[model samples]
Target chain A: MNFSSKILEDAVNEMSQLPGVGKRTALRFVLHLMRQPEQQTDQLSTALTRMRHDLKFCKKCHNVSDGDLCEICSSPKRDETIVCVVEDIRDVMAIENTSQYRGLYHVLGGKISPMDGIGPQDLKVRSLVERIKKDGVQEIIFALSPTIEGDTTNFYIFKQLEGIDIRTSTIARGIAVGDELEFADEVTLGRSIAQRVPYESSIKN
Target chain B: MNFSSKILEDAVNEMSQLPGVGKRTALRFVLHLMRQPEQQTDQLSTALTRMRHDLKFCKKCHNVSDGDLCEICSSPKRDETIVCVVEDIRDVMAIENTSQYRGLYHVLGGKISPMDGIGPQDLKVRSLVERIKKDGVQEIIFALSPTIEGDTTNFYIFKQLEGIDIRTSTIARGIAVGDELEFADEVTLGRSIAQRVPYESSIKN
Candidate 1:
């Protein structure tokens, strides 16, 4: 699209660089911003710039933070020894939102995807190992997705724990809580049956 | 969702204020920005802030511009006597993209929507009339949408141009070029039949 103003074109171009936003959507966003007060645009730009400039990564979990340690890691109430492993901070946030687990997190930054040229070394794998060896982490829970990359990363980490004295586990896989059994995929339904928990154990939760 | 950092939370809140973006989507955009180099974030913020700060509206046409007059208004090649009235700059861009209209534009800024408390006075309607009278315009085309508000705005402007010598017209309403007749809405289909042009003229176009 031909923009009449260089500034408008530049702003739309930058906005379109975001994931899921196309050129037309970017133009819409730019025009929306134009309709608002100048202060609103200033506030948005200031927040993003400051966040990018001063944002810090937690030294232990690699989650975004304002200082050396993240809020979860620094909180005394959270379980330090039971660390949940995940692909990124988004997973960390999702698991945290559940309030089901009280453990700390270990963010891998991204999964080990060979197709994307991302290997174990490209993530926080080394630091996780060092953390397991140095910290008295009793249990490491794999909370990654059920995708191939998630499985590969889980296996890679499992091998890394060969000599370590830590109990490792993965999140349960089954039909979702509210989903109909008839609609469940064949693999998931079969796995749910094969790995079925005892009635008493399942009811305990 | 709880964010680990104040900066991250603030940025997410600001980003989520945009239309159609929820908190989760905001976090995704924020994280995507976080993964990129700081320069990208700087560039985006700079472009937005600069555009908002230094942007100007064209004096003659009221379209977005960097100077007193917009590019379209200043271009001698465009027909100054034939002005196409539109709702906003986006409409202007859309018509320009067709590469068909060579007329100048008059952006109304918005349509007449009583439900939204927007009336004729809230728009650039007065200036449009002044331009038509002062520029010796021969014709004025209403390119507004077919929505109730769009029609109301067009009629209101048409009434304002009653005493003027210029002829007035609206963009044609018909089934879209590639649309199926069976799927067309009742109103559009009826309008297409009632406003049918001479077959020879339609074929020539």
Candidate 2:
């Protein structure tokens, strides 16, 4: 797409660099910004710049934070002994919304995707190990997604805690609460049956 | 969606103010920025700010431009007697891509939409009329989309040029190229049949 103005072209080019955004969508976004008041653009720019420059990560859990520790990590009410391991801060938010887990979270930042050149070293694995040792975390919940990369990251972290005396468990894989059993995928259904719990335990909650 | 950092939340909030962007997608964009190097965020913010602050519109046609006159308006090779009226710069780009029209364009910025409280006075109608009279344009072509608002805008402009000695025409509305006639909508098919051109004219370049 040809643009009459170099400034518009530059803005579109930069916007198109985002994941999943194409030239046309970027152009739409740029044109929309141009139509809005100058103050809107200024606010957007200031917010993004401030976010990039001032945002910090929790020193303990690696979750995004404005200070040295994230809200969950700093909260005294959350269980420090049971730490849930996840791939990113978004996952932390998702789990937090459920209100089912009251423990702290360890955001790994990303999964072990060898195809993407992201190895164990690229993640916060070392810090997580040191965190477990330093905090004496008793129960570690592997809340990573059910994918090959997620499994690989989980196993890598499990191996890192080999010498430690901690009980590690993964989140359950089963059909959704309201979904029909017939529509459940074969792998998940099989796993649900294989890992079936006693009826009493299942209803305990 | 909850955000761990206030800066991150502000960025997401501002980003989500864009058309079609929701809080979830905004969060994704914010998180993606956080994962990249700080330079990437800086470039994006700077480009957008520069575009908003430094961009200019063509004084004649109202299309986005780096100078007072747009490329098309400034080019001596373009036909000065023929003007294609469009809704915005995007329409100008679309028409330019065809490479068939070598005439100048007048961007109205937007169509008359009572639902949106947009009227002819809010557009560049007065400037367009003044330009036509000053330049002695011989023909006017309306290339707006086939919508109620588009038709209303075209009619409004046509009424404005009622006493002027100029020929006015609208873009031909017919079944799209490669579209099956059987699949064509009733109104379009009827219009295409009623407005059928001579066989020689249809086959002519």
Candidate 3:
């Protein structure tokens, strides 16, 4: 779309670069910003710039943090010996929201996808291995998604721990809680049946 | 949802302040930014800041611009005698995209909506009247929406143009091209029939 103003066009161009936002949505967002107080625009720009400039990555898990270690990695209450490996920080937040796991996390930053040119080396795989060996982690849980890339990443990490004494496992695949079985995909349903746990174990959660 | 990093939290809080963005979507956007190279974030932040800080409003039409006057208002190719008054810059763009109107535009910035506490005094209505008198505009077309608020704003402007020699008109309301007649609303269908023009006049377009 043609914009009358250069600055308005520039703002929309930048906004449309986001994942799901298109030109029209960007225009709407820019117009909304224009309607608000100039201070609101300043706040938004300051917050985004500050976040980008001042943000740090956790040395241990590669998650975003204010300092050397993220809250989950530094918390004494979290299980340091049992680490849950995830694709990114969003997975860390999702698992944290569940409040079911007490283990620390290893954020790979991305899955090992050959199509995207992201190999095991591109991720935080080396750091995770070094962490397990240095920290003497007892068990490593693969909490990655059920995609082929997730399986490949899990296998890659499993191979890396070949000589190590640490035990490795993946999260159980099953139908989501409160979901209808009839609507579940065949692969998931079959996997749920194959990995059926004891009634007491399932009910406990 | 809780954020592990303070910078992430601040960015998400500011992003979610946009019209349609929620906390979850804001978090998703923030995380997406975090995953990209630092330069991408810098570009986005820089563009937004520059747009907000350096943007100018057109002196005549109140539309966004880089200089004192907007592109349409400053262009000699545009018809200075006929002006289309719209509710906002988006409306001006939508009308311009049609390429049917050769006249300049006057952006009201907003419509008269009592429910939203917006009135005639809050818009650029005075400047529109001043332009018509000073520039000797022959015709004024209302390109606002067919909403009650749009009608209220139109009537308010019409009252201001009393005793003026300029001819006033509104955009026609009818079934959209390629739209099924059966799907058309009763009010729109009735208005279209009541304001029916000669077949020759309609076919000329």
Q: Which candidate comes out best when scored by TM-score?
A: 1
TM-score of each: 0.97, 0.95, 0.95
B1-205 per-residue lDDT for model 2 (tens digits): 7677888889999999888889988888888898799999999999999999999999999988888898888999999999999998999988888888999999999999999999999999999999999998999999999999999999999999988999999999999999999999999999999999999988876
Instruction: Please give, as one word, the docking class of candidate 1.
Output: high
Task: Write the residue-wise lDDT of candidate 2 on A126-198 in tens digits.
Answer: 9999989999899999999999999999999999999999999999999888899999999999999999989
Give the Å error, residue A42, model 3.
1.5
- The DockQ score of candidate 2 comes to 0.81
DockQ of candidate 3?
Answer: 0.74
Worst 10 residues of 2 chain B by lDDT: B1-10
Question: Considering only N, C-alpha and C atoms within 3 Å, which residue pairs clash in candidate 1?
Answer: none
- A26: Cα error in model 3, Å: 1.1
Q: Write the per-residue lDDT of candidate 1 for residues B1-112, one digit (tens) a residue.
A: 9788999999999999888889988998998999899999999999999998888999999999989999999998998999999998999999999998999999999999
As a TM-score, model 3 comes out at: 0.95
A best-first ranking of the candidates according to their DockQ comes to 1, 2, 3
In model 1, state the lDDT of residue A116: 100
Error of 3 at B160 (Å): 2.4
Q: What value does the lDDT take at residue B38 in candidate 3?
A: 81
Q: What is the interface RMSD of candidate 1, in Å?
A: 0.8
